[model samples]
Target: MPGFRLISFKRCPYVQRCVMILREKNVEYDIEYIDLSDRPDWFNELSPLGKVPVLEVTRDDGTKVVLFESAVINEYLDEVTPGSLLPDDPLERAHSRAWCVFGTALLSDAGDITMARDEETLAGDLERLGKKLDRLEREIDTGPFFLGAEVSLVDAAFVPALQRLAWANEFHPAMAIFEGHPKVARWWAALADRESVVNSAVPDLRQRYEAYVGRDRGGYRSLVGARIAA
Candidate 1:
């Protein structure tokens, strides 16, 4: 197999998704970490939106193609790899895709909660996220993974968001984001031991994530908590 290069940022959940998939598939790939605030000129040529997780595939014949966006990258990878994370039926695949989009929305709204400027806004974001989580809870199958026996694209897609919530709780137990979502919580607990998920980010991911959220424009300084950094 021709090894690929992953242009990545250390902390972006979007990038984590792709990295996890590569890890899960046991693909031959190398990651080159880049600071989002100080990207090189060629990065603009490769990534239209200047995002992390731009995969550069060098074919056996020396041809190269750069792909961007986490979703597109995941889908393309699934297609090329032997085992499929998506469903075989067209309708089921479409449904899975829709859920992946929903997962993205959840991640976005959670970011809003982290950056909520006031207690009122924070409470509102929490309520909205709570309602959406209830929907997700209802949607969850009896699973160690998203679809029961197998882990799907949905699992890889949403695990990063779930991970962020878990780390945030370590600093500020206020959110209780998973309170009413037992199935989602279970799914997260299951992924906790997954090697692919574990290797996606740095070993000190909790601290890094906290540092970023601690600087949120909102009153999220609490994300760092009182504990001293190790």
Candidate 2:
């Protein structure tokens, strides 16, 4: 509507990434919330996919840049802003960016696990998710953060995922996703404590997310003997 307007959904992790980037950059932007199940027509004009975290940049000259996809938007913001969300070395930057893709893939895998109807399907999806987590565990070194001290785009990319998996572990205590991932556990705990990550989503989110996951006609609620179902 003004300088910068971020179209968002109250609980989307992708939108949260953009929020974290905005907080990191200290950029003041307006936000308009929407329900994904019932999107407004104008939203289609803003995003081809009709998704949230769409940034509408209205420059002083009156031209506008409406951008979709959280990764692309955050990357553009880093270039325009003073500080870097990625590494200085080009190779390191590329590697970090690839992890960002992996982060999204992790989300997909988790969703597949969560929405899996059968024990067999859940087992397969869990293995896939576990393999991804193993890869993430292998990359760990010194970290109060994922890539090191200062929070990078990789950290931004993963804030949503880490929290969800943490909740998943909570919902079913026997299903500890972070088990044997000490470095990742440390990284997750630190990131969870950060002001940027804390304020990224709305309050009472844990309750809301838990309710959503356990809703009627669901797989998550079927936390039977199977660990993944749990």
Candidate 3:
């Protein structure tokens, strides 16, 4: 078996997804957290895109290979593990992959909401995010996980965004991110307590997240987050 090393940024949602997959597969690996603002030379050399969640694979033959991008790294991890997180059917697997892309868009929207500079910007961000959530609610046929009862790669992809949105909603209920989106809300509830999801990030992630988004960032959401943190 090849050994793995994951390069991560402490608060990156992308990195969190990789961590969740690693834990779900019960894969033993070493994770090195780096300061994204001051990335080390080794990381710069390993990551072509200069991104987090870079996977370093060391084969038994002593050859090393580097992989970047969360989605690709996740697929690689899933394929190497015992049971597959994707469906056996090709079309079903493609459908899951498409939704995984949607999950990344959702993550981007959540980031926009956190960094909105004014009420107008915040309102627009909320509207865009709400539309995506509505679409997700309709797309989900079954509850708990994205595809069904058992967790899939889709769940690992979506959970980080859902978790962050839930936190923002908690701090500012007016966001109403989950309001009227019962299916998506249920999905979030289901995965929120899973061991892999819970331990995907640092223990003080909430505090760290709040501080990042709210800390004198000059954004309207930051003001709200700052007030709540205080």
Candidate 4:
């Protein structure tokens, strides 16, 4: 019934990014959860790339607009919404964007290494990720939120990654990296406490990840076991 539709996969980081932005902007939009294996034909027609977090804007007059990529969707929402997520101050905005990009990039790298389930590299990669968290802790001021006193797009963008990182640590005891960084732990805890992060999160990650891994040509143990043993 809403004017916008977000095509998303529940566990996808990119989709989480878009959801976070939409929630922060207080935008009303409908969400369609897509099965990656059996996507709806309509979605394929709209986005040939077949990626999730696609934003479809339908005007009252029946015009349709589609956008792919979480960053683009976030920018679009910021423009359309009355309140700004990125500050008007150029320097602050740049710093905020830098933090978002940094969190995403670090998490992506960590995911790649973790997904391999390699016994040797998992520890090292997790350590590197922990270092990034340490940096974030150093960068941020005292916060109930990321930009000092309030939640912003940067806070939303990074929170899901922190959630995943925590999951990684919980599943894989070897990734107890944040234990040393109290600030990082507090930041993550605070971020996770938000309504948007809570509402947007998908709790079936371990099962989905297990199924996805099972489908691979080279089979591995359940993600839970792999993490426990790794």
Q: Which candidate is the best by lDDT?
A: 3
Off by over 4 Å in 3: 218-223
Q: TM-score of every model? A: 0.92, 0.91, 0.96, 0.86
What TM-score number comes out for model 2? 0.91
Q: lDDT of each prediction vs. the true structure?
A: 0.81, 0.81, 0.90, 0.74
Candidate 2 — worst ten consecutive residues by lDDT sum?
220-229
Look at candidate 1 and give me any clashing residue pairs: none
Candidate structures ordered by lDDT, highest first: 3, 1, 2, 4
Q: Which ranges of candidate 2 are over 4 A from the true structure?
A: 218-230
Q: What is the Cα-based lDDT of residue 149 in candidate 2? A: 83
Model 4 residue 11 lDDT score: 67
TM-score of 4: 0.86
Candidate 3, residue 123: CA error in Å? 0.9
Question: For residues 1-230, what per-residue lDDT tens digits would candidate 1 score against the true structure?
Answer: 66689998888889888888898888989898888889888888788778888999898999998899999999998889999999999999999999999889989876777666567877888889888899999888778787788888998889888887776555557788778788988999999779989988878876676676665344334323322232
Model 4 scores a C-alpha lDDT of 0.74
Instruction: List, residue by residue over 1-230, the lDDT tens digit for candidate 4.
Output: 33889998866877888887788778898898888888889888988588988999998889888999887788888888887888899998888888888878866855655575566566566667767877777887787677867778887678767776776667666567577777777778888867787777466755665455334436665443464454
Candidate 4: minimum summed lDDT over ten consecutive residues — where?
A: 209-218
Report the Cα lDDT for candidate 2: 0.81
Q: Is candidate 2 or candidate 4 better by TM-score?
A: 2
